[model samples]
Target: MAEPEDKTRRAPLDAVGRFTATEAVAAALSLIWLVAVAAYSFTAPDGTGPLGIVMTLMMVFLPIALIWVTVTTLRSVQELRAEATRLQSAVESMRNAYVTTQVQPSVQRKLEEIERTAKQAETALATFTSRRDASLVVASADRKAAMAAPARAAPAEDQPALALGTPAEDLRAPLSVGDFIRALQFPESPEDKDGFRALRLALEDRAVAKLIRAAQDVLTLLSQEGIFMDDLKPERARPELWRSFAQGERGRGISGLGGIRDRSSLALTAGRMREDPIFRDAAHHFLRTFDRTFAEFEKTATDAELVDLADTRTARAFMLFGRVAGVFD
Candidate 1:
């Protein structure tokens, strides 16, 4: 079915279209000569002059030449159509062979790996969540008991009272990135596989997505001017110190955003991304793709480990952006 369609699309110009200019002229000449011969044959009384002989010869052979030309042309056209069909079939076969031997297997392997990773993450998340819930329950009960009991004497000056567990927020304190520079100092984490899955679940929350994007936008803007995360030194990682540079603070041996050649400030770059339609659309697309990679992580209950992943991933983004931007030497 497809082969005939391909041949039709690839049909030769001379095979199917109107006759060429030379062919048209020849056909027209033949027709005019035949008409002239017929008129002369009817009017002439005797076949004795040169005109009679010429007319007689033309009338006899002209029809034979026209018939021979038509037959030859029809055969030539049939040959071109057959050749086009064969070429089309060969191309289709080669394309199918390439897809079967190369593209299909590679795509199949990637799909299988993604499926396997998702299952592992799901199982890990469930186990982590159950343990966290049990801890929270125990912590709650102890808190209730302490509150209902009478007040006790204050501890000695050097001693501090210890509880079974600390508050949930305190446990998750490591994820906070109030100072972007401080968050990126460390790159080594053996638990990165576990952490990655935990963070994937955390990104399901819109707030986490917004934070990561903010850091990514900052890095992307800096990269445009050839300035990079790695250009930033460790000292520049502190939130207060970095803000000093961003705010164009003096007394650092440099002027307002002096290191950058574009004369564009970080504040301005950030504002541009925030206001521009193109950038907003790009940010939305990034989050959508990022969310898809860890879609299954969000289905289970929340675990402290998952929350930690969110924190770690956010801080990691800042650290990575800074390093890539050369913010830390």
Candidate 2:
């Protein structure tokens, strides 16, 4: 409604025949000059020849022609004014957009959240890097210590052998499937006392200890390539599918168990397998270890326990690395 009213409003130069104040004033002056010229042409003291008639006609219309030309120039000026108004409107809209962006609440919060997550990932990666090297050192040193142990403590030939002391692991309770899954996730942080406790208990089991060590090595190596189990979100397979895998099913029958579908992760793993010999070896070792250990555990694991195990970070890594290794194909 307001737009219609604005369109109807008067302008100096409109679509209809109209004149500006200056143009009207100029026309009035030109009319007066024509009247004076008519009076002189009729009442001239000199002879009224054809030359005098020609001069009078020129004087009559020249001022009106000049005024008409000036009005056309003023119409061009009016168009320029309209364009300047539109440009001013566009500038105002841009300023309003800038103000709106500044007031959005999530902008600042999202930035902070992203920064915090990146720092946490960096810390976890660094921790595992050290653990990977330490595990290698500890495994080699243990081999050396075990080989030297028999020579250091020789059995007596005649004297009665003293009763052998109980092994260190005999004092600790056996690791349960639940504890094994928790241990595979590893301690969330230094303050995660419960998580650490579960890991320590799981480590007491001879078979589980080997699987956990292999998992840690593969996890640490994958992190070096910027892939983390925490970042993967595998599509959860059915418990029956997991049971089939545990029961030695292979190929497409159990292919649904490979739930990791992130293309970028698969590409990275495939590339690493092709280019990095150490990473490829570690991946193969982890998968074989996981498959054998998990099959044994599945014999006793309830459907709920199986689901929980599948949800563990270690299981997720298996899905990702195994798919790239053609375990699901």
Candidate 3:
């Protein structure tokens, strides 16, 4: 059955509208002319010849035919316009149906997850910048000196121990793997005293500090390309895989460790590696430092600690650069 009429449809006299005033006038005038000519032809003038009769017939049919052609053209145009409207409606319906069927929860979840990560990174950056010149900086310097002093120490006989049996260096216990991992992540906020404390301890370990500084350099370079270590989401490889890479395995043997698969990031990094010699050198140095540090870290670090360390921003940066450099093939 035909659907109920659309009241708003003004389309081309398909259902509701009447013929226009001009069309109606033309049709009425043509019919009047035809009737008048027929009547005049019947009451022919006396002595009229065949020429006059032909002329009468010509006048009778010509105007009517022209008006019929005009009306037919208008109807064709109206039908064309109606067809166009139906085509547009069909397209709109198809688009809405496609959108309804194609959208999925996974894509929405991924976007939401990405947004949350970005917010967290922004918060961490703002917090770190505000506290950059506070007590943290001072403690950092003191820690560096304390760390270096141990290296430049005089003979054991020449230097005296602290009260009781504690050496000056022994006052603080060794930096634990947990603290090292925390330092790699850096302070999340000015109020996170534990984060700050772990960083300070990490700085006091000369080896770890050197690695930290190298990682910092690489991170700074990466930022110029709008890539952030915090934004990277590398696949978490097993601790055994990292240990395998640290033990001098290369190519596919440790390839799983390089989980940074973002094509744009890799392309930008690859371009920089080829064009900038200084950046290339620094990246290589950072990789070496990370490799060495992780080797030592894994020896005493539990599997969970190793995974946490791998997830840190510093380690993420390493994964990005390492993948680009083909360190893990």
lDDT of 2 by residue, 85-170 (tens): 66776788899999989867678899878976865564455334432233323322112211111124567888777567857665
RMSD of each: 16.3, 12.7, 11.7
lDDT by candidate, in order shown: 0.45, 0.74, 0.75
TM-score winner, 1 or 3: 3
Write one digit per residue (lDDT tens) for candidate 3, span 203-223: 877788998889889988999
TM-score of each: 0.30, 0.58, 0.58
Candidate 2: where is the Cα deviation over 4 Å?
1-165
Better of 1 and 2 by TM-score: 2
Per-residue lDDT tens digits for candidate 1, residues 1-329, read 55445544455643547565556666677777778767877897768899978878877577758855885676587767767787888999999998788888899999989966865665466445443334333332112211112245787989877885664533442222222212222232655554454344334334444444555564465466454544432211222332343333434322221233322344444455567766545544443433332232222213332332333333333433322233433
Alpha-carbon runs more than 4 Å astray in model 1: 1-31, 43-45, 48-55, 63-71, 78-82, 132-329
Deviation of model 3 at 180, angstroms: 2.1
* Candidate 2 pairs with clashing backbones: none
Any runs in candidate 3 off by more than 4 Å, and if so which? 1-167, 188-194
In terms of lDDT, model 3 sits at 0.75
